[model samples]
Target: MIRNLLVAALLAGSATVADAAQWNFSYVASVGTISGQIDGTLQGDANTIFVSSLSGLQFNGTPGPALPFLASASSVVGGIPGPPALSLDGSANNILACSTDTVSSGCTSDGFAFVPAGFFAPPPVFFSGPAYGGAFFESYNAANWSITPAAIPEPSSWTMLIAGFGLVGAVVRRRQVVTRAA
Candidate 1:
């Protein structure tokens, strides 16, 4: 009975630790709406979230860029405008480019280009409703965004969790046998 309880407890703890974080995002523009999934990671000791990788990106029913896009949000301070900022390369034509700015034009980069405070209201909030903005090349007038966390466990994490559970079970069982004999 004790062994079962111990194993269960250990397993539960491991499960929690094995969870990985993910980000789900979507945006709407006049040209069309784009939605996709991004692998997310927490920035160091801050209330900021970063998108490390992107996958399953679809823009207006077409496959989107696979480049890495970085996003971050700042809190409103002293009545100053705090908005979520996204960084990506832009082509010479001011079109959204790939991850790197130095990349050649028409390299199929992923990015956004807009004049600050030109279209959307001031102070864009993270994970909030649509943010209206003017996007060059495309008629992207409004952008709706959302962020979601995903849980993914690394292989090493699984291995360590299993090993920990085994160790804990062994210790608990040894204690139980000693108590019985005593």
Candidate 2:
């Protein structure tokens, strides 16, 4: 019984160490504001996806690290007015506040983590819906974060080590119980 409990604990710890989140985004215009975004759902719902980074050349042609935030007024194409909402293909995150500093050297890449004030990345939505009659969810980023697809073994190793110790304890317990019975 003790041995089984030990093995279960080890396995649980290993599983957590083997997970990573991938962040992605899509660029859209002709239906966004320069301030807020309102991504509406098309078929009624959206699928959840992980996020990590944003890629592709931006509107201004500054190739490095495109818009970090999804469909911000400044991130949209053609530039819309302030407090605009970028419609989506599913249930949206319904943001209340959003802002980013200038992407120039020191200030650039400052804070990418979506934190308080209604900033966050919703799960991945399909590339459906049409903005300019094309792939509505235009350009964004899809960062795949895995356990290096290799370090995944580290967790298993830890589990084995712990389980080995537990086995030893179980053996010692059994011996004690047997001696007491005799």
Candidate 3:
């Protein structure tokens, strides 16, 4: 009986390790509405793993280009203290390229960044201009930055849970069989 309990406990614990989450983020910016899904493990203080890897990214209504490796330090997820929100930094250290057109493969001429208050240089936030001859730069504040938790148990987690239940069921069945024979 103790062995079965121990096995169940270990399986339950292992499921926690394989837990994962997906956060859908959206907010208005000077350029347009920025939105995407961030996929990563929701384990506390380790949420930076989802910073650079953004999916379903869109600007206004157009799809954004594939992003390069962004700095994890410039972003924050549910793994830290504060409101359940996602904060992205596009400071000089983390220059995030703003995709303006669907044809460009990279951020050759345009870029934007979110400089957290009191973190980098002054003026808080700003958006840069496009590379197609017309140059423009403007400063704006980013508000309503929403980051919500959408969790899904990993496959290994489900497997471990099912196996644990099966093991416990077997143990109970064996006990019943022994009692009936006696």
Candidate 4:
């Protein structure tokens, strides 16, 4: 019985580890002399990025995207209304970061934007402007961002737990039968 319990405990612990969620994130940006944190999440497929929250964010001493723009979505290159070419470091890289053209249509560059695969590319910079279009652009080395994996269990984790319990029960029952025969 003690052996069975040990096995069950080991199985349960392993299940928790398997269910962990890895999230890569970074929120560092600076315009001129001011910089702040940008909060967001990257989808599992690496196709979409969502800016769920923002705080202490600014550009050249001006408040960045308003609160209403926080929950916006940005898609990959093949996505609809992809982003524009981004300027990182000193050279311009052709990566569709975000679209600042429309705000009401849900494709504004204020919040959502796409990053390259592996989430290693720099985040785009968005400046508040008119809904039609104005001074908005993407820069590679403008912001400080990081990707971190969150510890959240997936459905498979539950399955592992159940299977572990069943194994423990089976081992216990067999042990009891052997003891009775003796």
Candidate 5:
């Protein structure tokens, strides 16, 4: 039992804490500054869905099919309008190190990271920061950039959780039958 408990604890810790480290930046056009909140969920969770690295994070309008969820990888949040080549300037390459999760301080050129058309789910653009840095995104309103504290749960987590509990129940039933026979 002790061994099992230890194993469980270790697995839990690894799932939630292993990847916890530095942060990166994302550009939310609405906020206009870097903050911590890629879309609505937190990318900080290692187990969750969050881009592990970000180099030059910027997107204008990229048109794709309509998807309800968001993307921690795609620089183009699906179903936007047009990722019209960013309006670059001399400042395009001047990326700030570990800057805002949204709105790069040096992104004065491509100030508009993601300009939405109607309503896209996860903002409509994602950028990765060096694992040592942080990963974040701008809010829908364009207030400031925010960090995605952890990874968000995809559809799989929920399905797995339910199945795990069912397994536990089956084990308990088998033990009960054995005890009654003895």
Candidate 6:
């Protein structure tokens, strides 16, 4: 019984680790700074993850328009529309872009891109523009990108773990009492 409880607890704990992960990203852009959280499952390549959704996405320390759900990674090239190149690479070695409008409509409406070294041009590369074509587009110098994973276990997880340990202790204590009586 104690062994079964131990195995059950171990399996339950691993389940939470396998679920979706939360990645925090932040970068300074020409127009302003952008920061947000990406939630999704990591792909085979640890550096990339298929984006499921975004939260806390802000521009210049203020919230911006809602971004269209992206199917995959892409690029933000001078406010020009293009495919999702290496946008989702968390390593920051590739271009990372986000679109406010539907991806099908193009990134022209409103979007931001973070370009690391070895991009189309040299260093100091970033593309940003206003929403709904407000006529505010600029490529500024010096952009930084940081993406890291953050995880917090749920309260239920702790409760289950503690209960499992308690059960194991009770079984061991009962066995000791029986041995002494015999």
What's the distance in Å from true for residue 20, model 1? 5.6
Please tell me which model should have the higher TM-score, number 1 or number 2.
Answer: 1
Stronger candidate by lDDT (4 vs 6): 6
Query: RMSD in Å for candidate 3, one decimal?
Result: 8.9
Name the better of 2 and 4 by TM-score. Answer: 4
TM-score for all models, in order of appearance? 0.46, 0.22, 0.47, 0.39, 0.28, 0.53
Q: Between the candidate structures 2 and 3, which one is better when assessed by lDDT?
A: 3
lDDT of 6 at 11: 46
Residue 3 displacement (Å), model 4: 1.9
- Model 5's alpha-carbon lDDT is 0.33
Residue-by-residue lDDT tens digits, candidate 5, 75-96: 3333322212211111111112
lDDT of each: 0.44, 0.32, 0.49, 0.44, 0.33, 0.54
Per-residue lDDT for 1-182 in model 3, tens only?
Answer: 77877887777667753344676766565456666776554435443323435567666667665443333223431122222123432222222434443213323444434433443445554443342112233344544465665566788788888888887778888889989999
Residue pairs in clash, model 1 = 20-152, 22-150, 97-109, 97-110, 98-109, 98-110
Highest TM-score against the true fold, candidate: 6
TM-score of 2: 0.22
Q: Residues 109-157, candidate 6, lDDT per residue (tens digit)?
A: 4655444444454543455556422323334343355677767566676
- Candidate 2 regions exceeding 4 Å error are 1-22, 27-63, 66-182
Q: Which number leads on lDDT?
A: 6
The better candidate by lDDT, 1 or 5, is 1
Candidate 4 regions with alpha-carbon error over 4 angstroms: 16-24, 31-138, 162-182
Local accuracy of candidate 1 as per-residue lDDT tens digits, 39-157: 54454543344445566766666765554433221221122233233322110001222344432332234454322332334532212111212233443233244445556777776
After superposing candidate 5, which stretches have Cα over 4 Å from the reference?
1-34, 40-149
Which scores higher on TM-score, 5 or 6? 6
Clashing residue pairs for model 3: none
Name the lDDT value of residue 39 in candidate 5: 23
Q: In angstroms, how far off is 36's CA in candidate 2? A: 19
